[model samples]
Target chain A: MVVRKYFKIYLRFLSRNIQSSMEYKVDFLLGILANLFQSILGLIFIWAIFNRIPTIKGWNFHEVAFVYGFAIIPSGISELFLNNVWLIPTVYVNQGNLDRILTKPLNPLFHIIADGFEPHGFGFIIFGASLCVYSTLKLGLSFSFLNILYFMVMITSGTIIYFSINLFMATLSFWLMDIVSSMVLVHHLSEFAKYPLIIYHKAVQIILTWVIPYAFTSFFPAIFLLKKGALMLSFLTPAVAISVFLIAYSFWNFGLKRYQSSGS
Target chain B: MVLKSKIKKYLALSKINIQRALTYRISFLTSLLAALIQLFVMFYIWKAAFSEKITLAGFTYSDMLTYLFVSQGINNIYGWYTTVERNIAYKIRTGDIALDLVKPLRFNFARFFEVLGISFVQVFFIIIIFTVFKILVPEFRTPKSDLYLFLFLVSTFLGFLCMFSLSFLVGLMSFWTLNYWGLYYVKKSIFDFFSGAIIPLQFLPLSIQKIAVILPFKSIVFIPTLIYLGKFTIHESIFQILFQALWATALWISAVLMFKLAIRKVVIHGG
Candidate 1:
């Protein structure tokens, strides 16, 4: 019942964002144009790389695009819906906005995550999804009922992993009192998920898998979607999702205990 | 005599700015870490090419690595001081620019020098750490030639000019737009792609490359890095430097005209 209530609040918050965005129609439309152009430019980089070479370590353009597209979909959606994830730690540490959020009836995390809503990101998400669909079809991969179910589960899991990683970084504000550059680090690491994990050396592959679990964000999803990898570990998607969600919540709770709120 | 006072004031402001930037040790260290990750990703991409027995267009492993390091270094130096720019623009839009306009010091030049000084502290630390890591890490190979060193410095300075002018233009948008964020966002997106920051420009298609070259973007990063890799002859390097200078002059003039016009607009509209 609490979850349902929060969902309704989120829906209302989203409508408010749309209303606010609508107030500046010309600027918003220009933003959409710039965003679409930027995303297409990103696509051109991938196209250029593939045009030069047949494959990078046995991962063809289609497979690589699959990874890029899927990773971008979650990233774009996250940016569009939860743009405050980009700025929460800064606000939490610098302005002690957390104090204001703490006094509110809504969950502080939900409030922070809903602080900014960027409709421009939805364009990128749609573009990435279409690319994903086209790439899957081009690879002659047949999507069955089970595969569709698995894909949906894994993508959600990927989103959770991304969120948890970012929250964990934000939690460091309790100690370091700043997380802007740390967020930049996370953004850069996500760029690596654009290509095949195998293209990297064994050490890097280990880092991605064991240290950051970036592989779960794209590599594992691509592996399953392509049906080239073991399905046994693939079914563990929900487990991974649950673990990451728990980790983020635990870390945030712990950090809250230690947070020395800036007296503003 | 008045010029001497202006120079003294600029120097004093720059010193304070640089000192404050140096105090942010964690931000500095993380920036270095980000640079290292970028270096490694480029290295891996090139390494994978070697493993696959594929040559990257015309670039060899050495060329690729050198390009990545130099471009990465240049990017750190040229990234916009968006907060500073926004603050300045905000003051202008609100008529508070009159206070600075009346100050004995040249407002824009003072602000430029202040940011340049802060960047000196950050860029110097970046260079030292990069040098130590390059000598220690095998993946980093030093670019060949004294010409590269000379051209790299030239390119970095000109790159800063191009970006500064572009940022100034974005700042001018505050006059008519009432909010400069749209302009800032657009500037960031264009610079990130065309300046060889996110992905190498060489990896972009021939048509895109042609478009990028004609813009101020190539002058921001790629030209300098490519020159450093011995990819250009002495004549070409000289020509590239001249090109950067010409573009910088053009942009600087544009910024001045825009600022003058924006002042009139702001005064009339009470923006």
Candidate 2:
């Protein structure tokens, strides 16, 4: 019953944001087109990297494309859903704007996260899906029902993990006073997950796997989907997603308790 | 004597802006950390690419590795200049540009100097950090020669002017389109592809090379990088720096004209 109520409220937010976006038709189209250009530029970067080489350490172009394509989908979903997290440090915590959110009956974090509905993220999702199809065709893999199920499950967990990371990072704004820098820091960190993990050093691989675990979002599951035999480890993504969100939730609560409102 | 005092006012504005930009010391540290991690990512990828091959295009494995870190460092000469977009966009949005324009100060010079102020702080930090990396890492390279270093500095300054002019023009677009998100990304995507920030234009395919010829973005990174790498002779380096100066002048003129036109069109919306 509670979930249904929240769902209705979120739908209202979706419609309102869409309405505002539609009010500026040119701006709306340009926004999606800009996202399309950025994602396409990313693909070009991969192509440039591969242009001078036959393989990257044993991985072919299509396999890397498959992984890169897989990585952006979850990122896009989280971007579409929780785009407001980007504003938290600069606006909410720093300027004492959280007071309004705190006064609301709904969960403040949920309100903040769900308030933003970016149609720009659709560019990434649509492009990434098509890239996946192209690569899958090149690899000659059958997209059977079980395989499709696994992709859906893993993609869903990956989105949750992306949201959890953004939530956990935004929660740091409550304590750190200004997390915009660290926010950008982690934004760049996500780019590292687009490629295979073995190419990186032991330290980076370790940090991506354990400390931040963004590798689980794209790299591990991608390798598993490619039948590269990290089968048991890739299965851990859903568990990792749940635990990470729980920890972030508790941490957010802890910070909320310490949230002494900033003043002018 | 009157002009001297006017110059003093702009310098004081720069001083104040520098102080304002430096208050986020925690931010400085985190941005530095971010730069280092990006360097690591580039290092590993290029390292992997070069594993089975000694060179890509004309770059040796070491040349490629060094180019990655150095180009990124030089590109970030405008690290804090990213704020210029946000500042100008906000000013135009809130109708603050009118107040700013009416001031005795020339508005464009003020905005340009504001870039100088923040980037002055940034240059120091970026230099120190890159220096630290050079000492710690064997692969981090120095300029090819003292002459090349001088030429690199000349080229980079001209490049900075060109970039700042383009940025101001992009920000001016807010007069017509109130939202800044799409504009910022569009500008960034252009620069990312054309500026040689991601990869050298020489390494890219011929089609991209043909496109890079028409875009001024390559002057901002590729020319300065090649100058520092001593890839060009003295005659060629001089020609490249002159080309950068030409672009810099052209872009500034365009920005000024656009700013004039855009200012008249600014109507505070929903008022």
Candidate 3:
């Protein structure tokens, strides 16, 4: 019942934001166009990188794009659904808006995350799905019902892991006073996951795989879908995601204990 | 006497703006640190590529680093946002430009000087810190010669003009659509990619490189970096500089004309 209530509230919140955005017809149109250009540039960057090199650690351009494209869906949706998560910690700290959020009946974190949904992120979803179609066609992969189940399960797990990592970083604001620098660092670190982990040195690859597990967000998912890794590794996706979430949840709870609201 | 008075007011406004801009110390520091981290990341990527004992593109590891460092330097120089254009659009749309026009100075000149003054200060701090860090860091590549240095500066000046013109055009679009952010984003993405801010243009195909050369965006970073790397002959450097000058002049003229057209069409509602 509580989950349903939250869902309804989230839908209402998203609808209101869309309406607000639509009020400025120019901004809405321009924003959509701008997002399209950025997405195009990102796609071109990946294409250019792959063109220069035949294969990066045995993954070709299409394969890399497959990972990037799949990962974009969740990340883009996260930006749409949880775009507020990107701004809330900073703006709340600066504007003292966290006080209002805290007063709300809904969980403050959930409420904050639901703010600022960029409806334009839906474009990324379309582009990503197209890439998925292309990659599957190129690889000539036959999909069974079990494969469909595995893909859905792994994609959900990947999204959870990605969100948890960002949330864990945002939670640092409770103590750090400013997590913007840390946010930049997190962004830079995650940029490495755009490519195959094996491209790095053995030690670096190990760190990405074992230490941060950013690879699980994209590389592991693509690998599972493509049947590159052992069947067991594919099954390990949900387990790893759940563990990361649990770990990050602990950190968030710990930080909340020290939440000294900046009374602006 | 009027020109002299306008110039004085411009300088004063610029100083005030720069001082105000410097107050954002945290943003400046974070951006500088981010740029340095970005430079280091590019360095490592090149290092890994070279380690494979294979030459993928025409560039060696050191060449790539040098190219990227020069690009970073140029990026610092042309880093001004079209605050004037955006703010002007906002002002004009809301009739705030009337207040600005009634001020003792020429509205256009004042806005230009104010933004330039602010950017100059921001760029100064960034350059000083970047230069100091580059000096201290063993890995950072320094531009080879004084001539190369001069060309880089000249090209960067041209870059400033290009961006200024772009923001001017985008801002003027507000007269018709009354929206500038979308235009700003589009211009930013193009400049970021074609200007070789994010990735080296050399990594791209020949056709793309050919197209990029004629585009004013390359004058911002790629041409200057090429000069710094000694990839171009002195004659070629002169040619690039000439092209930059031509582009700058063209953009300056375009900005002036666009402003006139925009002003004629502008339907200022109210304050």
Best by TM-score: 2
* 1 against 3, candidate with superior DockQ: 1
DockQ of each: 0.46, 0.64, 0.41
In model 3, pairs of residues that clash are none
DockQ for candidate 3: 0.41
Q: Which is the better candidate, 1 or 2, if ranked by DockQ?
A: 2
RMSD values, in order shown: 3.2, 2.4, 3.7
Weakest ten-residue segment in model 1 chain A by summed lDDT: A230-239
- Candidate 3 has an lDDT of 0.72
lDDT of each: 0.74, 0.83, 0.72
| Better lDDT candidate (1, 3) | 1
TM-score of chain A of 2: 0.94
Query: A14-96, model 3: which lDDT tens digit per residue?
Result: 79988887888777777777766776676676677667776655666778778767767666666566666557468875566
In the range A1-264, model 1's lDDT, one tens digit per residue, is 999999998888889988998787766765666666666655666676677778777778888788878877776766677667767667666778889888899888898887678877776678778888999899999788987787787777877877778887877777775677877787679767766787787887887776777777777777788766856555665677678779878988898877777883
Best-fitting candidate, scored by lDDT: 2
List the candidate 3 regions with Cα displacement exceeding 4 Å: A90-94, A172-177, A201-213, A227-236, A247-264, B1-6, B36-57, B80-98, B121-144, B174-181, B198-203, B264-267
Residue-level lDDT of model 3, residues B1-271, one tens digit each, is 9878768878998888777767765655566666665565455555655565355567766677667776776676544332666677788678776677568875556777877876787677767866775677555566668877787677677777776776667677777665776767777788889988777787778998899888888877778788777788888989988998898889878887877766655434332
